[model samples]
Target: METPASTATAETPRPVDRADRIRSIDVIRGVALLGILMMNIPYFGLPEGILGSLKFDHPGDANYLTHQVIEILFSGKMRALFSMLFGAGVILLTTRKEHSAGLSIADIYYRRILWMVLFGVIDAYVLLWTGDILYAYGLCGLFLFPFRKLAPRYLLLASLVCFGMLIFKGHLRFQDMRGKREAYLKVVALEKQKKKLTDKQKDDKKAWETVVKNGKPDQKKINDEIKNVRSGYPTVWAYYLPINTKIQSSVMYEVYFWDVIGMMFLGMALYKLGVFTGRLRRRGYLAMLLIGYGIGIPLGWWVHQETTLAHGDFGRYLDSHFLPPNRMTYDIRRVTMALGHVGLIMIIYKSGWLRWLTGALAAVGQMAFSNYVMQTLICTFIFFGYGLGNFGRLTYYQLFYVVAGVWAFQLVFSSLWLRFFYFGPLEWAWRSLTYWKRQPFRISQPDSETVVSSIQA
Candidate 1:
């Protein structure tokens, strides 16, 4: 957020030094960043496919132990927390510049996102996994451009609709899966009526049992699991019609894109309402937490559980069904959970004790651009093709080592770098590119008193 005075100082070439920067947002960003890795660490430690599995798919004593720890601790919740921060940041940065004299809000905002799209592409293609949210976020930011200036209530309504649409779409999928519920009933009924369970029942019993108590994800087992998803599950898109596929594409785009935008708008609205400004009453913040937590978590957990029950089972017979069954119930829950993420932020912010965690987190968030790339580079070195080639090899528990190692590295480096510069290196580059000027990279400043004396002489 370049202020009017800051813009003037830039034009006159007043050098920015250590004292000129704001610590609060940087702290906030750093906190958000640290939390992101807590979410990403498991992915780093495991094969990519294990992301949505009911059970850790790989085998071996070492890998099996790894999976359990990750599922229990670093699963979905932390990432959801990071997404809320991204939303808050969108508002924080944009609003800061909105009333400034130099960079037009529209100009800087669009250029910023355009640059992010390029960055996301490169990150996706060359650095790490192609499943990059940054690219989706870049695209989604465009949709948010027009609504930035609408009245808060209007923006609020728009965001709600987009989010609600996501929920509705999920509901439709859940309903579709319900028709297949009868199949499960038949299998269970048949097994029970026989007075002895068959092989199919045994397999299901296996799914319910959670194999981890007995095993770990070993390379040989991972190879087998990968083979299973790729070969064992036949590619029967027979039920996945072109229209439905298109619908899916659109739904996913909205799901990833709009959930983020909706949160940003909500944050922006909150900001306008003076929440982020620290003006909201304690009760108000408390109320938000209660509402979000009370409503969101249970709803989200229900969705997660239902979806797992409904469509988590992959069957040779389901070659007839292309769409996943838990769509709708789960979708509704994701939306509520996302709101719950906001509630979490408020709770954390209100806590004086959380300053330490938030400080570490903000350090990461401040260098998100750099840290995000760094995460990929380090993980690829640890797991991917170019380095150890350990993908599909490490245990789920071993993931913590990777995560802890990376967290230590990022924390030390981000703090060290901030000491010498106004922005993270990538953040500097982004701002420079967006402004289309060679912004100063150095923080050293000329003596103003000396210049004044010289002018008087």
Candidate 2:
């Protein structure tokens, strides 16, 4: 007869192996981070309206083309990828310390989230632009821990509920626009046919021209945008209120949480299926990737196009704001496109060609906590009065250059930092503060001393 402890050990799955750790997650995160720069670059350079306007008009055919390319390439995809990663992060952290008895895990987690919220509030007011996701993410983190033990099917159902509800909400809005009939059809026709913008349309062109032209933003633009951000822009304050922001950012932040958690479940399922660290046969994942991309990308593209149109609903939606709010098609498509991007990341991870790309990217991913805060710090200097003070001056195209510089800085710094230290600066500090004990800083290795562990290994 087997004892209960021995019986339990016999049935339990093994922990993830050191060599078996998944790089796909890191790779996907890296790609998402870079892709984020594509969208953020514009904000870093231009005015708020420019982000939306570029979709409809540009300075010329070239500018129009540039915006279109970015829309297809970056647009909604990166954010979705980040959201999925956020979901995955929850699973990772929960498991990291599941067996450790000496740690006050829940207390530590609560403090970590509190610190995150504190940093987010500080970042929003002092240094960076008010388009802060950190604050939203931190608030959401508080509720995520409880979901860690949910079964896969249940996880899938929750994700679908979160994602599907958003789409359903969007579908009604689109249906309403179709009922109005004239404006919706006209806008679609113009976009599909690629009609040249009339003079009036030219002035209304949307693109990030501000940040590119100005290295930092002019003080005036910063003050104006901040005011608009805080005011939530013409009833925008309603958008940011805890109630409305919760709903508005619900799909934006929490939806990603669901998707990511779903992916972690998917990843767990895949792990059970034998995929990570080369355990799964290439052909298996290859088929899944191909099939997934084949369907997901085009579908993503279509929905993305649809959501772009939802912005047009602003006036109509506002006109009837007093009534039960009208739903729009744009919302429906955002969910569809977001799903497509998730499929794309899954496929890319399966490709196996992403080793170098994933490795460097994982470097950034490993230090994501640090890089995230670093992004706030760096962008503040580039965009706020404390630094060059040129927030709303640069154009969209010019932002690419600044991003390149930052990318170079982050990549090199991340790689170098990892060599000398065990964690990114902030990450180390976060751990120390959370646990109230200083973790070891360096590993003493009797090495020919490789470049990998530079600080004190």
Give per-residue CA lDDT, model 1, range 1-457, as digits (tens). Answer: 8798777764542223333333344454454555566556655555544543423333345544444333332344445445545555566556652233466778878888999888876675445444456776677777676665666687667667766776676656544444344445556677678767677765655543343222333556556544432321122122113423443356546476666666666655655666544466667767766776676555554443444443334333234345543443433444444444444555566565566555555556667788878887787566544456565565455566777788888877775565445567888888888878766664454365433221111
Model 2, residue 309: C-alpha shift (Å): 6.4
Model 2 weakest lDDT span, ten residues long: 203-212
Write one digit per residue (lDDT tens) for candidate 2, span 1-457: 8998866544442233223445556555666776677776676556664555544444355545567566654565566656656666666666663323355557767777788777666555444444565666677677767876776566556655655555565556545534444343444567679986565444323221221234333567655665444332233233234533453356555344443343444433333334333454556556645554465456545544444444444434434333222223332333444444545555555565555555667667667767876776787567654466565566566667788888888776766665656566776776667666675555345253534423111
The local lDDT score (0 to 100) that residue 149 gets in candidate 1 is: 65
Off by over 4 Å in 2: 1-22, 97-100, 171-280, 300-355, 443-450, 453-457
lDDT of 1: 0.55
